[model samples]
Target: MYNSIKEIVTAANETGKTIAELTIEQECQLSGKSRDEIWQRMTVNLQTMQAAVQRGESGRGVFSQTHLTGGEAVKIKNYRASHHPLSGDVMMAAVQGAIATNEVNAAMGVVCATPTAGSSGTLPGILFMLKERLSLTKKQMIDFLFTAGGVGLVIANHAGIAGATGGCQAEVGSASAMGAAAAVEAANGTPEQSAQAMSIAISNLLGLVCDPIAGLVEIPCVKRNAIGAGNALIAADMALAGCTSKIPTDECIMAMDKVGRGLPASLRETGIGGLAGTPTGQAIKARIFGNEV
Candidate 1:
Protein backbone atom coordinates (compact mmCIF):
# COMPACT_ATOMS: atom_id res chain seq x y z
CA MET A 1 0.00 0.00 0.00
CA TYR A 2 1.18 3.48 -0.84
CA ASN A 3 1.75 5.90 2.00
CA SER A 4 0.10 9.32 1.80
CA ILE A 5 2.11 12.51 2.30
CA LYS A 6 0.55 13.11 5.72
CA GLU A 7 1.23 9.55 6.74
CA ILE A 8 4.89 9.79 5.75
CA VAL A 9 5.35 13.06 7.60
CA THR A 10 3.74 11.55 10.67
CA ALA A 11 6.03 8.55 10.48
CA ALA A 12 9.09 10.80 10.13
CA ASN A 13 8.12 12.80 13.22
CA GLU A 14 7.47 9.65 15.14
CA THR A 15 10.82 8.19 14.14
CA GLY A 16 12.61 11.46 14.83
CA LYS A 17 14.41 11.00 11.54
CA THR A 18 14.78 13.00 8.34
CA ILE A 19 13.18 11.86 5.11
CA ALA A 20 16.52 10.78 3.66
CA GLU A 21 17.45 8.84 6.81
CA LEU A 22 14.01 7.29 6.93
CA THR A 23 14.34 6.28 3.32
CA ILE A 24 17.60 4.58 4.12
CA GLU A 25 16.11 2.87 7.14
CA GLN A 26 13.15 1.64 5.12
CA GLU A 27 15.49 0.42 2.40
CA CYS A 28 17.56 -1.38 4.97
CA GLN A 29 14.52 -2.99 6.47
CA LEU A 30 13.32 -4.20 3.09
CA SER A 31 16.55 -4.84 1.23
CA GLY A 32 19.10 -5.55 3.92
CA LYS A 33 21.87 -3.16 5.07
CA SER A 34 23.24 -2.40 1.62
CA ARG A 35 21.48 0.96 1.28
CA ASP A 36 22.53 2.07 4.73
CA GLU A 37 26.12 1.06 3.99
CA ILE A 38 26.04 3.01 0.73
CA TRP A 39 24.72 6.06 2.58
CA GLN A 40 27.70 5.92 4.96
CA ARG A 41 30.05 5.74 1.98
CA MET A 42 28.36 8.80 0.47
CA THR A 43 28.79 10.70 3.73
CA VAL A 44 32.53 10.10 3.56
CA ASN A 45 32.49 11.25 -0.07
CA LEU A 46 30.78 14.55 0.87
CA GLN A 47 33.32 15.24 3.62
CA THR A 48 36.15 14.79 1.16
CA MET A 49 34.56 17.23 -1.28
CA GLN A 50 33.94 19.81 1.43
CA ALA A 51 37.57 19.47 2.49
CA ALA A 52 38.72 19.98 -1.08
CA VAL A 53 36.58 23.11 -1.34
CA GLN A 54 38.14 24.45 1.88
CA ARG A 55 41.60 23.76 0.43
CA GLY A 56 40.61 25.42 -2.90
CA GLU A 57 41.79 22.27 -4.66
CA SER A 58 38.67 21.56 -6.69
CA GLY A 59 38.21 23.78 -9.72
CA ARG A 60 34.78 25.33 -10.19
CA GLY A 61 33.43 23.59 -13.24
CA VAL A 62 30.30 25.11 -14.84
CA PHE A 63 28.96 27.53 -12.23
CA SER A 64 31.76 28.22 -9.77
CA GLN A 65 31.49 31.51 -7.82
CA THR A 66 33.50 33.38 -5.27
CA HIS A 67 32.00 33.71 -1.80
CA LEU A 68 30.66 37.11 -0.81
CA THR A 69 28.71 38.72 2.05
CA GLY A 70 27.45 42.03 3.51
CA GLY A 71 25.98 45.28 2.22
CA GLU A 72 22.84 44.56 0.19
CA ALA A 73 23.66 46.93 -2.70
CA VAL A 74 27.25 45.78 -2.85
CA LYS A 75 26.19 42.15 -2.69
CA ILE A 76 23.64 42.77 -5.42
CA LYS A 77 26.25 44.34 -7.68
CA ASN A 78 28.69 41.54 -6.98
CA TYR A 79 26.04 38.94 -7.69
CA ARG A 80 25.18 40.58 -11.02
CA ALA A 81 28.81 41.05 -12.00
CA SER A 82 29.75 37.49 -11.04
CA HIS A 83 26.55 35.95 -12.34
CA HIS A 84 28.04 35.55 -15.73
CA PRO A 85 30.57 32.87 -16.60
CA LEU A 86 28.59 30.73 -14.11
CA SER A 87 29.08 30.37 -10.36
CA GLY A 88 28.60 27.88 -7.53
CA ASP A 89 25.15 29.32 -6.92
CA VAL A 90 23.74 27.71 -10.02
CA MET A 91 22.28 24.22 -9.41
CA MET A 92 23.22 23.09 -12.92
CA ALA A 93 26.93 23.69 -12.30
CA ALA A 94 26.92 21.34 -9.34
CA VAL A 95 24.76 18.76 -11.12
CA GLN A 96 26.81 18.90 -14.32
CA GLY A 97 30.00 18.62 -12.35
CA ALA A 98 28.56 15.62 -10.55
CA ILE A 99 27.44 13.81 -13.70
CA ALA A 100 29.93 14.91 -16.37
CA THR A 101 32.87 15.19 -14.00
CA ASN A 102 31.89 12.43 -11.54
CA GLU A 103 32.47 14.90 -8.69
CA VAL A 104 29.53 14.14 -6.42
CA ASN A 105 29.71 15.24 -2.77
CA ALA A 106 26.38 13.92 -1.49
CA ALA A 107 22.90 15.07 -0.46
CA MET A 108 20.57 12.24 -1.50
CA GLY A 109 22.62 9.70 -3.44
CA VAL A 110 21.38 10.86 -6.83
CA VAL A 111 24.09 8.73 -8.47
CA CYS A 112 21.62 6.00 -7.80
CA ALA A 113 18.35 5.70 -9.78
CA THR A 114 16.19 7.32 -7.06
CA PRO A 115 17.85 10.69 -7.66
CA THR A 116 19.68 11.96 -10.70
CA ALA A 117 23.33 12.85 -10.11
CA GLY A 118 22.97 16.16 -11.94
CA SER A 119 20.09 17.41 -9.78
CA SER A 120 21.76 16.14 -6.59
CA GLY A 121 23.15 19.47 -5.42
CA THR A 122 19.93 21.29 -4.46
CA LEU A 123 19.01 19.56 -1.18
CA PRO A 124 22.50 19.47 0.27
CA GLY A 125 23.44 22.86 -1.11
CA ILE A 126 20.39 24.55 0.43
CA LEU A 127 20.97 22.82 3.76
CA PHE A 128 24.66 23.74 3.83
CA MET A 129 23.95 27.31 2.83
CA LEU A 130 21.33 27.60 5.57
CA LYS A 131 23.69 26.11 8.10
CA GLU A 132 26.31 28.66 7.13
CA ARG A 133 23.81 31.46 7.60
CA LEU A 134 22.25 30.22 10.84
CA SER A 135 25.29 28.54 12.40
CA LEU A 136 23.09 25.56 13.16
CA THR A 137 24.52 22.69 15.14
CA LYS A 138 25.01 19.27 13.57
CA LYS A 139 22.03 17.93 15.50
CA GLN A 140 19.81 20.73 14.25
CA MET A 141 20.92 20.10 10.70
CA ILE A 142 20.07 16.43 11.08
CA ASP A 143 16.67 17.32 12.45
CA PHE A 144 15.98 19.61 9.52
CA LEU A 145 17.02 16.82 7.20
CA PHE A 146 14.62 14.41 8.88
CA THR A 147 11.77 16.83 8.39
CA ALA A 148 12.64 17.21 4.73
CA GLY A 149 12.88 13.44 4.38
CA GLY A 150 9.33 12.96 5.47
CA VAL A 151 8.16 15.25 2.70
CA GLY A 152 10.40 13.52 0.18
CA LEU A 153 9.14 10.07 1.12
CA VAL A 154 5.59 11.28 0.55
CA ILE A 155 6.53 12.55 -2.90
CA ALA A 156 8.28 9.30 -3.75
CA ASN A 157 5.32 7.23 -2.69
CA HIS A 158 2.72 9.54 -4.24
CA ALA A 159 4.70 10.80 -7.25
CA GLY A 160 8.28 9.76 -7.96
CA ILE A 161 11.96 10.92 -8.03
CA ALA A 162 13.13 9.77 -11.46
CA GLY A 163 13.06 12.39 -14.20
CA ALA A 164 13.13 9.70 -16.83
CA THR A 165 10.08 8.31 -15.14
CA GLY A 166 8.35 11.52 -13.98
CA GLY A 167 9.97 14.29 -15.98
CA CYS A 168 11.17 17.38 -14.08
CA GLN A 169 8.38 16.88 -11.57
CA ALA A 170 10.30 13.86 -10.36
CA GLU A 171 13.64 15.64 -10.61
CA VAL A 172 13.42 19.38 -9.96
CA GLY A 173 9.87 19.25 -8.68
CA SER A 174 10.65 16.67 -6.05
CA ALA A 175 13.84 18.49 -5.09
CA SER A 176 11.97 21.75 -4.70
CA ALA A 177 9.29 20.04 -2.61
CA MET A 178 11.93 18.46 -0.43
CA GLY A 179 13.75 21.75 -0.06
CA ALA A 180 10.51 23.56 0.82
CA ALA A 181 9.60 21.06 3.48
CA ALA A 182 13.13 21.20 4.85
CA ALA A 183 13.08 24.96 4.91
CA VAL A 184 9.76 25.00 6.74
CA GLU A 185 11.05 22.59 9.36
CA ALA A 186 14.24 24.58 9.71
CA ALA A 187 12.10 27.66 10.25
CA ASN A 188 10.14 25.79 12.93
CA GLY A 189 6.95 25.50 10.95
CA THR A 190 4.41 22.94 12.14
CA PRO A 191 4.07 19.58 10.37
CA GLU A 192 0.91 20.85 8.65
CA GLN A 193 2.76 23.88 7.32
CA SER A 194 5.57 21.70 6.08
CA ALA A 195 3.10 19.61 4.14
CA GLN A 196 1.51 22.76 2.75
CA ALA A 197 4.91 23.92 1.59
CA MET A 198 5.36 20.69 -0.28
CA SER A 199 1.97 21.17 -1.85
CA ILE A 200 2.85 24.65 -3.02
CA ALA A 201 6.08 23.40 -4.53
CA ILE A 202 4.39 20.63 -6.46
CA SER A 203 1.67 22.98 -7.64
CA ASN A 204 4.24 25.42 -8.92
CA LEU A 205 6.30 22.85 -10.84
CA LEU A 206 3.42 20.84 -12.20
CA GLY A 207 4.43 20.33 -15.82
CA LEU A 208 8.20 20.73 -15.85
CA VAL A 209 10.00 18.20 -18.05
CA CYS A 210 13.40 16.49 -18.25
CA ASP A 211 15.16 17.75 -21.31
CA PRO A 212 18.91 17.50 -20.90
CA ILE A 213 21.18 18.34 -23.82
CA ALA A 214 23.46 15.79 -25.44
CA GLY A 215 22.14 13.35 -22.90
CA LEU A 216 23.92 15.51 -20.32
CA VAL A 217 22.35 16.85 -17.14
CA GLU A 218 23.78 20.29 -17.72
CA ILE A 219 21.92 23.10 -19.47
CA PRO A 220 18.52 23.54 -17.80
CA CYS A 221 19.19 20.99 -15.08
CA VAL A 222 21.55 23.17 -13.02
CA LYS A 223 19.71 26.45 -13.47
CA ARG A 224 16.52 24.66 -12.59
CA ASN A 225 17.88 23.81 -9.14
CA ALA A 226 18.52 27.43 -8.30
CA ILE A 227 15.01 28.23 -9.40
CA GLY A 228 13.76 25.22 -7.50
CA ALA A 229 15.52 26.35 -4.34
CA GLY A 230 14.02 29.78 -4.68
CA ASN A 231 10.64 28.23 -5.20
CA ALA A 232 11.10 26.14 -2.08
CA LEU A 233 11.79 29.28 -0.08
CA ILE A 234 8.70 30.95 -1.44
CA ALA A 235 6.54 27.94 -0.72
CA ALA A 236 7.88 27.61 2.78
CA ASP A 237 7.19 31.24 3.52
CA MET A 238 3.66 31.01 2.22
CA ALA A 239 2.99 27.92 4.27
CA LEU A 240 4.49 29.47 7.36
CA ALA A 241 2.22 32.49 6.87
CA GLY A 242 -0.74 30.10 7.04
CA CYS A 243 -1.60 30.20 3.36
CA THR A 244 -3.03 26.96 2.09
CA SER A 245 -3.37 25.75 -1.49
CA LYS A 246 -6.70 24.63 -2.82
CA ILE A 247 -5.12 21.38 -3.91
CA PRO A 248 -3.69 19.21 -1.16
CA THR A 249 -0.13 17.89 -1.23
CA ASP A 250 -1.16 14.37 -2.14
CA GLU A 251 -3.38 15.63 -4.95
CA CYS A 252 -0.60 17.83 -6.23
CA ILE A 253 1.77 14.89 -6.34
CA MET A 254 -0.78 12.85 -8.21
CA ALA A 255 -1.29 15.68 -10.69
CA MET A 256 2.44 15.85 -11.25
CA ASP A 257 2.51 12.13 -11.92
CA LYS A 258 -0.29 12.48 -14.42
CA VAL A 259 1.41 15.36 -16.16
CA GLY A 260 4.70 13.46 -16.36
CA ARG A 261 2.97 10.46 -17.83
CA GLY A 262 1.49 12.65 -20.52
CA LEU A 263 4.86 14.05 -21.60
CA PRO A 264 6.19 12.86 -24.95
CA ALA A 265 9.25 10.61 -25.02
CA SER A 266 11.28 13.42 -26.55
CA LEU A 267 10.63 15.59 -23.53
CA ARG A 268 11.32 12.81 -21.12
CA GLU A 269 15.15 12.54 -20.49
CA THR A 270 15.90 11.24 -23.94
CA GLY A 271 17.58 14.58 -24.70
CA ILE A 272 15.54 14.97 -27.86
CA GLY A 273 13.36 17.96 -27.08
CA GLY A 274 13.16 21.34 -25.31
CA LEU A 275 16.60 22.96 -24.92
CA ALA A 276 18.19 19.74 -26.00
CA GLY A 277 16.88 20.36 -29.52
CA THR A 278 18.44 23.81 -29.66
CA PRO A 279 21.37 24.61 -31.94
CA THR A 280 23.74 24.91 -28.99
CA GLY A 281 22.81 21.44 -27.78
CA GLN A 282 23.36 19.97 -31.25
CA ALA A 283 26.74 21.70 -31.57
CA ILE A 284 27.84 20.46 -28.15
CA LYS A 285 26.84 16.95 -29.13
CA ALA A 286 28.83 17.22 -32.34
CA ARG A 287 31.89 18.34 -30.43
CA ILE A 288 31.54 15.61 -27.82
CA PHE A 289 30.25 12.71 -29.90
CA GLY A 290 32.01 13.47 -33.21
CA ASN A 291 28.81 12.90 -35.18
CA GLU A 292 28.58 9.40 -33.73
CA VAL A 293 24.80 9.62 -33.71
Candidate 2:
Protein backbone atom coordinates (compact mmCIF):
# COMPACT_ATOMS: atom_id res chain seq x y z
CA MET A 1 0.00 0.00 0.00
CA TYR A 2 2.85 2.38 0.74
CA ASN A 3 4.61 3.61 -2.39
CA SER A 4 7.95 4.31 -0.76
CA ILE A 5 9.95 3.78 2.38
CA LYS A 6 9.55 7.42 3.37
CA GLU A 7 5.80 7.14 3.02
CA ILE A 8 5.69 4.02 5.15
CA VAL A 9 7.91 5.55 7.82
CA THR A 10 5.99 8.81 7.82
CA ALA A 11 2.72 6.97 8.17
CA ALA A 12 4.01 4.83 11.04
CA ASN A 13 5.31 7.89 12.89
CA GLU A 14 2.32 10.12 12.23
CA THR A 15 0.24 8.77 15.11
CA GLY A 16 3.25 8.06 17.31
CA LYS A 17 2.18 4.45 16.99
CA THR A 18 3.79 1.32 15.67
CA ILE A 19 3.04 0.10 12.16
CA ALA A 20 0.93 -2.68 13.68
CA GLU A 21 -1.29 -0.15 15.37
CA LEU A 22 -1.77 1.73 12.13
CA THR A 23 -2.55 -1.43 10.26
CA ILE A 24 -5.09 -2.54 12.85
CA GLU A 25 -6.66 0.90 12.77
CA GLN A 26 -6.96 0.66 9.03
CA GLU A 27 -8.51 -2.80 9.25
CA CYS A 28 -10.96 -1.62 11.90
CA GLN A 29 -12.00 1.32 9.79
CA LEU A 30 -12.59 -0.89 6.80
CA SER A 31 -14.50 -3.49 8.77
CA GLY A 32 -16.40 -0.89 10.82
CA LYS A 33 -15.51 -2.72 13.99
CA SER A 34 -14.01 -1.63 17.27
CA ARG A 35 -10.42 -2.65 17.98
CA ASP A 36 -11.56 -5.13 20.61
CA GLU A 37 -14.04 -6.62 18.23
CA ILE A 38 -11.46 -6.85 15.50
CA TRP A 39 -9.08 -8.61 17.80
CA GLN A 40 -11.78 -11.03 18.89
CA ARG A 41 -12.62 -11.69 15.27
CA MET A 42 -9.03 -12.53 14.49
CA THR A 43 -8.86 -14.92 17.40
CA VAL A 44 -12.04 -16.60 16.29
CA ASN A 45 -10.67 -16.84 12.77
CA LEU A 46 -7.59 -18.66 13.99
CA GLN A 47 -9.71 -20.91 16.18
CA THR A 48 -11.91 -21.65 13.24
CA MET A 49 -8.90 -22.56 11.21
CA GLN A 50 -7.80 -24.93 13.89
CA ALA A 51 -11.21 -26.50 14.01
CA ALA A 52 -11.29 -26.88 10.26
CA VAL A 53 -7.96 -28.57 10.30
CA GLN A 54 -9.28 -30.89 12.96
CA ARG A 55 -12.25 -31.63 10.78
CA GLY A 56 -9.98 -32.58 7.87
CA GLU A 57 -10.76 -29.49 5.85
CA SER A 58 -8.18 -26.83 5.13
CA GLY A 59 -9.69 -23.66 6.52
CA ARG A 60 -7.27 -20.83 6.01
CA GLY A 61 -6.20 -19.31 2.76
CA VAL A 62 -2.91 -19.93 1.02
CA PHE A 63 0.28 -20.65 2.98
CA SER A 64 -1.27 -21.77 6.21
CA GLN A 65 0.64 -24.20 8.43
CA THR A 66 -0.49 -26.25 11.39
CA HIS A 67 1.34 -26.13 14.66
CA LEU A 68 4.38 -28.41 14.75
CA THR A 69 3.64 -29.97 18.06
CA GLY A 70 3.03 -33.70 18.25
CA GLY A 71 -0.51 -33.24 19.52
CA GLU A 72 -1.27 -30.90 16.67
CA ALA A 73 -0.06 -33.41 14.12
CA VAL A 74 -2.34 -36.04 15.55
CA LYS A 75 -5.29 -33.70 15.29
CA ILE A 76 -4.40 -32.90 11.70
CA LYS A 77 -4.13 -36.56 10.79
CA ASN A 78 -7.47 -37.29 12.39
CA TYR A 79 -8.97 -34.51 10.33
CA ARG A 80 -7.47 -35.90 7.16
CA ALA A 81 -8.89 -39.33 7.89
CA SER A 82 -12.30 -37.71 8.05
CA HIS A 83 -11.90 -36.52 4.47
CA HIS A 84 -11.90 -32.84 5.28
CA PRO A 85 -11.09 -30.48 2.48
CA LEU A 86 -7.60 -29.16 2.92
CA SER A 87 -7.31 -25.60 4.09
CA GLY A 88 -4.04 -23.81 3.66
CA ASP A 89 -3.09 -24.81 7.17
CA VAL A 90 -4.22 -28.34 6.61
CA MET A 91 -2.43 -28.43 3.29
CA MET A 92 0.71 -27.35 5.03
CA ALA A 93 0.12 -29.93 7.69
CA ALA A 94 -0.21 -32.57 5.00
CA VAL A 95 3.12 -31.50 3.57
CA GLN A 96 4.67 -31.69 7.00
CA GLY A 97 3.05 -35.03 7.46
CA ALA A 98 4.59 -36.19 4.22
CA ILE A 99 7.95 -35.10 5.46
CA ALA A 100 7.41 -37.00 8.63
CA THR A 101 6.26 -40.01 6.69
CA ASN A 102 9.14 -39.64 4.27
CA GLU A 103 6.97 -39.50 1.17
CA VAL A 104 6.35 -37.07 -1.66
CA ASN A 105 3.39 -34.77 -2.31
CA ALA A 106 1.34 -34.57 -5.45
CA ALA A 107 0.15 -31.05 -6.34
CA MET A 108 1.20 -28.22 -4.07
CA GLY A 109 -0.95 -25.15 -3.79
CA VAL A 110 1.36 -22.22 -3.18
CA VAL A 111 0.48 -19.79 -0.48
CA CYS A 112 0.24 -15.94 -0.84
CA ALA A 113 2.98 -16.18 -3.37
CA THR A 114 3.67 -19.25 -5.46
CA PRO A 115 6.18 -20.89 -3.15
CA THR A 116 5.83 -24.66 -3.30
CA ALA A 117 3.29 -26.15 -0.94
CA GLY A 118 5.99 -27.91 0.98
CA SER A 119 7.75 -24.62 1.70
CA SER A 120 4.46 -22.96 2.62
CA GLY A 121 4.94 -24.06 6.21
CA THR A 122 7.70 -21.52 6.86
CA LEU A 123 5.91 -18.17 7.10
CA PRO A 124 2.91 -19.30 9.08
CA GLY A 125 5.11 -21.50 11.21
CA ILE A 126 7.25 -18.52 12.11
CA LEU A 127 4.23 -16.37 12.77
CA PHE A 128 2.76 -19.05 15.01
CA MET A 129 6.01 -19.40 16.86
CA LEU A 130 6.19 -15.68 17.46
CA LYS A 131 2.62 -15.47 18.62
CA GLU A 132 2.91 -18.41 20.99
CA ARG A 133 6.36 -17.67 22.32
CA LEU A 134 5.94 -13.94 22.64
CA SER A 135 2.26 -14.07 23.49
CA LEU A 136 1.66 -11.32 20.95
CA THR A 137 -1.78 -9.80 21.02
CA LYS A 138 -4.10 -9.89 18.03
CA LYS A 139 -3.29 -6.32 17.13
CA GLN A 140 0.37 -7.12 17.15
CA MET A 141 -0.15 -10.12 14.87
CA ILE A 142 -2.27 -8.13 12.42
CA ASP A 143 0.25 -5.37 12.39
CA PHE A 144 2.98 -7.89 11.69
CA LEU A 145 0.88 -9.26 8.86
CA PHE A 146 0.48 -5.74 7.50
CA THR A 147 4.18 -5.07 7.71
CA ALA A 148 4.89 -8.32 5.91
CA GLY A 149 2.22 -7.44 3.41
CA GLY A 150 4.12 -4.31 2.54
CA VAL A 151 7.19 -6.33 1.69
CA GLY A 152 5.19 -8.90 -0.24
CA LEU A 153 3.41 -6.15 -2.15
CA VAL A 154 6.70 -4.67 -3.13
CA ILE A 155 7.94 -8.01 -4.39
CA ALA A 156 4.72 -8.68 -6.26
CA ASN A 157 4.78 -5.22 -7.79
CA HIS A 158 8.43 -4.90 -8.72
CA ALA A 159 9.70 -8.45 -9.12
CA GLY A 160 7.23 -11.30 -9.45
CA ILE A 161 5.45 -13.59 -7.02
CA ALA A 162 4.94 -16.53 -9.37
CA GLY A 163 7.53 -19.28 -9.14
CA ALA A 164 6.79 -20.31 -12.71
CA THR A 165 7.83 -16.89 -13.84
CA GLY A 166 10.56 -15.99 -11.38
CA GLY A 167 11.73 -19.29 -9.87
CA CYS A 168 12.34 -19.75 -6.14
CA GLN A 169 13.40 -16.15 -5.68
CA ALA A 170 9.83 -15.11 -6.32
CA GLU A 171 8.56 -17.86 -4.07
CA VAL A 172 10.95 -18.55 -1.20
CA GLY A 173 12.77 -15.24 -1.50
CA SER A 174 9.60 -13.20 -1.27
CA ALA A 175 8.29 -15.36 1.57
CA SER A 176 11.52 -14.87 3.49
CA ALA A 177 11.36 -11.12 2.92
CA MET A 178 7.78 -11.00 4.07
CA GLY A 179 8.59 -13.11 7.08
CA ALA A 180 11.52 -10.86 7.98
CA ALA A 181 9.44 -7.70 7.73
CA ALA A 182 6.70 -9.27 9.81
CA ALA A 183 9.15 -10.45 12.43
CA VAL A 184 10.66 -6.99 12.68
CA GLU A 185 7.23 -5.44 13.10
CA ALA A 186 6.34 -7.95 15.77
CA ALA A 187 9.53 -6.96 17.55
CA ASN A 188 8.34 -3.35 17.47
CA GLY A 189 10.98 -2.42 14.96
CA THR A 190 10.94 0.91 13.15
CA PRO A 191 9.68 1.04 9.60
CA GLU A 192 13.24 1.50 8.45
CA GLN A 193 14.28 -1.53 10.41
CA SER A 194 11.48 -3.58 8.92
CA ALA A 195 12.50 -2.52 5.44
CA GLN A 196 16.07 -3.39 6.23
CA ALA A 197 15.00 -6.82 7.37
CA MET A 198 13.17 -7.34 4.12
CA SER A 199 16.20 -6.21 2.19
CA ILE A 200 18.41 -8.65 4.00
CA ALA A 201 16.05 -11.54 3.34
CA ILE A 202 15.71 -10.71 -0.33
CA SER A 203 19.42 -10.19 -0.71
CA ASN A 204 20.20 -13.53 0.84
CA LEU A 205 17.83 -15.38 -1.48
CA LEU A 206 18.60 -13.32 -4.54
CA GLY A 207 19.01 -16.11 -7.05
CA LEU A 208 17.42 -19.17 -5.44
CA VAL A 209 16.20 -21.72 -7.93
CA CYS A 210 12.82 -23.50 -8.04
CA ASP A 211 13.80 -27.10 -8.59
CA PRO A 212 11.07 -29.33 -7.26
CA ILE A 213 11.89 -33.02 -7.47
CA ALA A 214 9.84 -34.92 -10.05
CA GLY A 215 7.64 -31.86 -10.40
CA LEU A 216 6.56 -32.36 -6.81
CA VAL A 217 6.61 -29.60 -4.25
CA GLU A 218 8.32 -32.05 -1.89
CA ILE A 219 12.02 -32.84 -1.99
CA PRO A 220 13.74 -29.56 -1.20
CA CYS A 221 10.57 -27.54 -0.82
CA VAL A 222 9.45 -28.74 2.61
CA LYS A 223 12.88 -28.41 4.17
CA ARG A 224 13.44 -25.05 2.52
CA ASN A 225 10.62 -23.52 4.57
CA ALA A 226 12.36 -24.25 7.83
CA ILE A 227 15.56 -22.75 6.50
CA GLY A 228 13.76 -19.73 5.11
CA ALA A 229 11.95 -19.16 8.39
CA GLY A 230 15.21 -19.24 10.29
CA ASN A 231 16.82 -16.84 7.85
CA ALA A 232 13.87 -14.47 8.16
CA LEU A 233 14.22 -14.37 11.93
CA ILE A 234 17.95 -13.80 11.66
CA ALA A 235 17.48 -11.04 9.13
CA ALA A 236 14.91 -9.36 11.34
CA ASP A 237 17.24 -9.56 14.32
CA MET A 238 20.12 -8.09 12.36
CA ALA A 239 18.01 -5.23 11.04
CA LEU A 240 16.54 -4.48 14.44
CA ALA A 241 20.09 -4.32 15.73
CA GLY A 242 20.68 -1.44 13.30
CA CYS A 243 22.26 -3.37 10.50
CA THR A 244 21.46 -1.72 7.19
CA SER A 245 21.58 -2.80 3.60
CA LYS A 246 23.65 -1.00 1.02
CA ILE A 247 20.81 -1.53 -1.41
CA PRO A 248 17.50 0.23 -0.94
CA THR A 249 14.35 -1.87 -0.70
CA ASP A 250 13.18 -0.85 -4.15
CA GLU A 251 16.58 -1.47 -5.69
CA CYS A 252 16.83 -4.79 -3.94
CA ILE A 253 13.44 -5.75 -5.32
CA MET A 254 14.54 -4.69 -8.77
CA ALA A 255 17.67 -6.74 -8.47
CA MET A 256 15.56 -9.73 -7.48
CA ASP A 257 13.45 -9.19 -10.57
CA LYS A 258 16.49 -9.05 -12.81
CA VAL A 259 17.99 -12.12 -11.22
CA GLY A 260 14.75 -14.03 -11.46
CA ARG A 261 14.43 -13.13 -15.10
CA GLY A 262 17.88 -14.43 -15.89
CA LEU A 263 17.26 -17.87 -14.35
CA PRO A 264 17.13 -20.72 -16.84
CA ALA A 265 13.69 -22.05 -17.70
CA SER A 266 14.64 -25.42 -16.27
CA LEU A 267 15.06 -23.85 -12.88
CA ARG A 268 11.71 -22.09 -12.94
CA GLU A 269 9.41 -24.95 -11.79
CA THR A 270 9.23 -26.42 -15.27
CA GLY A 271 10.61 -29.73 -13.89
CA ILE A 272 12.95 -29.93 -16.87
CA GLY A 273 16.26 -29.25 -15.14
CA GLY A 274 17.75 -28.64 -11.74
CA LEU A 275 16.87 -31.38 -9.27
CA ALA A 276 13.88 -32.33 -11.34
CA GLY A 277 16.15 -33.49 -14.14
CA THR A 278 18.31 -35.83 -12.09
CA PRO A 279 18.11 -39.62 -12.42
CA THR A 280 16.30 -39.93 -9.11
CA GLY A 281 14.05 -37.08 -10.14
CA GLN A 282 13.32 -38.91 -13.39
CA ALA A 283 12.54 -42.06 -11.53
CA ILE A 284 10.18 -40.23 -9.25
CA LYS A 285 8.54 -38.61 -12.20
CA ALA A 286 8.13 -41.95 -13.88
CA ARG A 287 6.49 -43.33 -10.78
CA ILE A 288 4.18 -40.35 -10.41
CA PHE A 289 3.44 -39.74 -14.07
CA GLY A 290 3.41 -43.41 -15.07
CA ASN A 291 5.63 -42.70 -18.04
CA GLU A 292 9.20 -43.38 -19.15
CA VAL A 293 11.67 -40.71 -18.12
Q: Which candidate comes out best when scored by TM-score? A: 1
| lDDT by candidate, in order shown | 0.63, 0.64
Superposed by TM-score, candidate 2 places the C-alpha of residue 290 at a distance from the truth, in angstroms, of 2.3
Cα lDDT for residue 195, candidate 1: 83
**Model 2 global lDDT (CA atoms, 0 to 1):** 0.64
TM of each candidate vs. truth = 0.73, 0.72
Candidate 1: list runs displaced more than 4 Å: 9-114
Question: What is the C-alpha lDDT profile of model 2 across 11-70, one tens digit per residue?
Answer: 877767666566566667776889888667655644432332233222321231222112
* lDDT for residue 118 in candidate 1, whole number 0-100: 53
lDDT of 1 by residue, 140-250 (tens): 666565556556766776677888888887887887788888778777777678789989988998889888777765566755765666677778889999999888788
Per-candidate count of clashing residue pairs (backbone under 3 Å): 10, 7
